[model samples]
Target: MAQPDVPDCPVDALTAECLSRIFSHLRPADLAAVACTHRAWRQAVAGEEGLWRAHCEAEYCLRSPHLPAGGAASGYKAAYGAWRSEFGRYGELAGRALRAWRLVEDWTAQHFPAVAASFGMGASEAELDAAEQQLGFALPPALRVLYRVHNGQELQFDRLVDIQRTAAHESIFHGMFGGYSFYSHLVSCRMLPLRRMVKWTRTAHTQLDFPRGDKRALFAASHNFNKMVYCDAADGLVKIACVDKENCLQAVPADAAGDPARDGALRWFEAYAAALSSGAFAVEALDAENPATIGICLFPQLPPGRSEAVTEGVRVRACPLLIPELTQVAEGERQYFFAYSIRFSLLPEEEQAALRGTLAGPAGGAPLESVQLRSRYWRIRDAAGQVVNEVRGEAVVGHYPLLRPGEGEFAYQSCTHQREPAGSMEGSFRFVEGSLQAPGREFDAVCAPFRLDVPDFIF
Candidate 1:
């Protein structure tokens, strides 16, 4: 006799065992995407605390020193022990992992003797107090704890860029090139042939020297993030460099020359500079009244079929929000939640057609004659996966045109005056056609995922 079929149960749809098996086959980001699919999946995945723990361990291993792989408990124990042994203080270990404190206690003593004692061993409260007074602002909380715990155990030294070497005599006519260096809150960029450095120094009164022209540019920024620098020559050459640490310097010949390259480089620089200034690309205090503004300097991936144009006008619109009233600092930082409705529009007919075609392809292809997209104030999740706040806004759009190949602007509305460190927004766009029915297509746009760090203003 055949057995009766078992009815499907909700738990059976996603049992812990099944979910674990599925997770093993996917990456962290992929797992995150899957988790966002539905509440059931989210609950199942969330229950598997082991998954997140393993992910954290893997990340720590990759970013920190070498370590053997094991279960979450083993990895955590090993990491904790290693950290304690290296730093001799829990606060110090945590600070280093968070990248809030540089291993500069000793370096500070060596270079700036006046402030060295306060950071050295057996430092007194009075000494630290005095130092803080002199600096004008309180030291980052993590750094403060690290200094108190580690004292003078200087394991990580601040890397200074060798500007003189990178700026020295390099071939200019071969093609356009550029270099970048960051110290604290300052980021300096110069054109190749090292000519731009000369112009910048003369015009901006910023001294730069190239001691070693062969070395690469330093990649250190105040906030933790990798940056890529590109140089386009007047002829048509393009050169690119990846900056990983501070005080780095390097040079390379451009890939092309002429107007196209120059325009591209200039556009990119503008966007990059804007991003840097906006505080959206770095860590900092969240103050709505003093909201940070970020800009995109270049749009190399411009709408296709219009590479020869010299100038393009891009429109950016944002719906602003004023909510999450001011409250005392939590976790030593002020908290506020602001929402924005962001949109991009005024795209050329050709570019719009290209976008529509691309969207209409096999996976996301949805035919449309006109498309207007907007995002509501969705919830913002912190690194801990906790809902910090919600954002609400209308759809704001911007139009960007390409005047020439490899050059364009990404001008848009700026509403970064919220008290949250970093949050992502996702929504859908409404598409319309002359003859077809209006249809909506989902799109995800990243509003500045970078940190907003407080500036260490010397003046």
Candidate 2:
């Protein structure tokens, strides 16, 4: 058979628009290959922000089925709506401040019962007066209202952990056991069933060891309790562990032998439990002290386009955003931006097979071949749009063994970092003959550029 006349011009001869239109018809992986062809092809694809947005939208919709459409637009709106409904506007500032004041008032009343009785109403009233006299600063309007409505008391978890078995075990085997064994760890803490309401008391303290640096210690305290809060979406939950003290002690260790230290620690746990039961401590204060708490709630945004199936199978559309602003607790202090990739599977096996066959290989199977398609490397740009960080990489593709008539699946690997915010990767594969022969042919792969954004922590 005579081969079609080779074009006089190079593949780069195609116009940018014409190239993009053709590239768009290819699968994402194939389109990437096209970019590796040359600088011009890369520029055509790299300039398109819409492509990245489409990927993000598809992932979001898959993860959050209840979320509305319009992709990222709908997802963001839904997240904001939930935030407002739960905490109200300016909730982060006002709600936190108000909650803090209420907690302080309650703490004063419980620890200073004598003074509280003198004031007739309780310690909260006296504490408020003392704050005004000492700080010479009036509480904010919202805070004052919150204090008036909520007399100081430890807020209880909607549920608490049951420790009856743990308490019994401790009482029965007091002297025989010095510390919890590995197998008995969860049982000793009464955490086996993973109950939502059960709470266990444990003491956590820090010890400064000369060579070892600062070592933090955590042990089951006499009356302290920990609650488990779960999040099905994140596939994990946070445990809110708390403790309190009637009078501050210098310090104590879990393995301490001295009766005085152990007695003081136990007393503190008793008081802490009392505070929690009586509603003396504020939940906001505890949360602020442990911002990295696993219990903190997270709200995720969804992606664009509804699920659809073509001859190739189902296509899931999603969009993901990289919010550098939320990457760290201290803004701009962190090196990497935190972002998530959104993905969803929409097609059945039959459709997926059809799509793969149409997209994977060249038109005629004259012993399959491979080729390079596209590559895009980007640099971090400054405010004025000057490239700052030099980022580069290439994409390639090539022929492989044909599948048996009924076999449709193929396996390949790509190395992409799940952490680094900026960098590039590139490489190529060559054909091999049985044993050790060379089949002088090669193919190209595509490298796509993307940025990471940290999603919002709504709760």
Candidate 3:
């Protein structure tokens, strides 16, 4: 009996349909592991379109419509393969963006507890599923994580802290009471709370009446400026729309989108998280009615070394790179990488008492606030006027430069990666007399527009 015993074929013995049923129970990663078992198993699993599709759907919530086209095969398995490949490239990036958002949450809770309290708890899977169903599109991963941590939040702004509606309040004092009449008053003002964001967004999408091809898409946040920050599904970028504009709703680039360091669409969630982490901007709130009593004073918190550096006077000027050096990029890609130089100079006059008065008080000894570059946001356009690339963010480099008079210039490098044959770059530097929070007078130093060109290859 022992001599007659024999081993059966491991997994290859299973029928294709049986194998598919078994693999369906595995996650995407587990499915991948078993795929390398044997030639027969690999072919059997790879060809099982339904199995791969099920894995993709379970992991990413991706359906047929969300899949990419032009694969060698026009089956679900090919689409799943394409998505898996793209996920491999972008998955880590999505994680980094989520980490950045979590940092922002921690910062907000520590610095602005009252505002943070309104954020609530992280979203549940069912809520996310409902939101996706309602929006009719899959949210980007970072944005999904952002909502899970907190449904939405209020940004900090001092003087202009509330969104203005077209109808003025009958009586501001009377509207403060808590009752049925107060509830009606709140609705009349068009207050947009993040928890009910989906409802208002649906209304905006259906009733606001953007052009036929241009839907209102989805809203990310509502601002005190009578604007709702929303996504343009047409471009997958974020834009700010004037909700209380004269006539129809008009959308414009959000502040982050206006910066040269950002994508033209501002790529919404990721860019916002990055901006918070980078200290390029701060979100603060104000609730006091009296400006004099407002708690948002910008003085008295100057960094220790800042006052000493500014007291001597710092000269600041803009230096442009008329020519940029270019290098060939990756294989099979036509893009070129160019590096441009920017130099800053601090003039002797920056130390004068008149300058001190404008910056800090003449008696206080001015501590420099910021040296920012302000210009029309830069972009590279092709012959058809399509934006090949757009830059965004604040300041030329991440930090403000402190330069001395006449001795030397502070040099920094900026780069642009473009596939276009020709394009140009231009912008100006804005010097903040005080600090970022309480910026005084802003002085503009312009950088004239420069051409981006590539010569014919000799070799």
- Cα RMSD of all models vs. native, in order, equals 23.7, 29.3, 17.7
Worst 10 residues of 2 by lDDT: 175-184
How much lDDT does each candidate structure score?
0.32, 0.28, 0.43
Q: Count the backbone clashes (under 3 Å) in each candidate.
A: 72, 65, 20
Residue-level lDDT for 48 in candidate 2:
50
After TM-score superposition, what is the CA distance of residue 394 in candidate 3 from its true location, in Å?
A: 30
Angstrom error of the Cα, residue 401, model 3: value is 27
| Candidate 2: stretches off by over 4 Å | 1-336, 339-387, 392-444, 447-451, 457-459
Per-residue lDDT tens digits for candidate 2, residues 358-459, read: 533322323232222233233444334345565444422222332222333222211222233342222222222111133333322221232333211111
Off by over 4 Å in 1: 1-367, 374-377, 397-411, 416-424, 431-459
Model 3: weakest 10-residue lDDT segment is 175-184
- How well does each candidate superpose onto the true structure, as a TM-score? 0.23, 0.22, 0.36
lDDT-wise, the better of 1 and 2 is 1
Ranking by TM-score: 3, 1, 2
Model 1 Cα lDDT, one tens digit per residue, 1-459 = 533343433566547688778886776557657667655566666666566556544443223332322223334334544443433433323433323223222333333332233232423345445544543334333223333433321111111122433332211110111111111211212221122222222322123342322222221111122322322222221222222212211222232434222232223333333333333222211221222311111112221200221112123333332222111134545543333323344345454345553422212333223433333344545645566666565543332221211233222333343345444433232222221233444333323232222111100
- Can you give the lDDT of residue 403 in candidate 2? 24
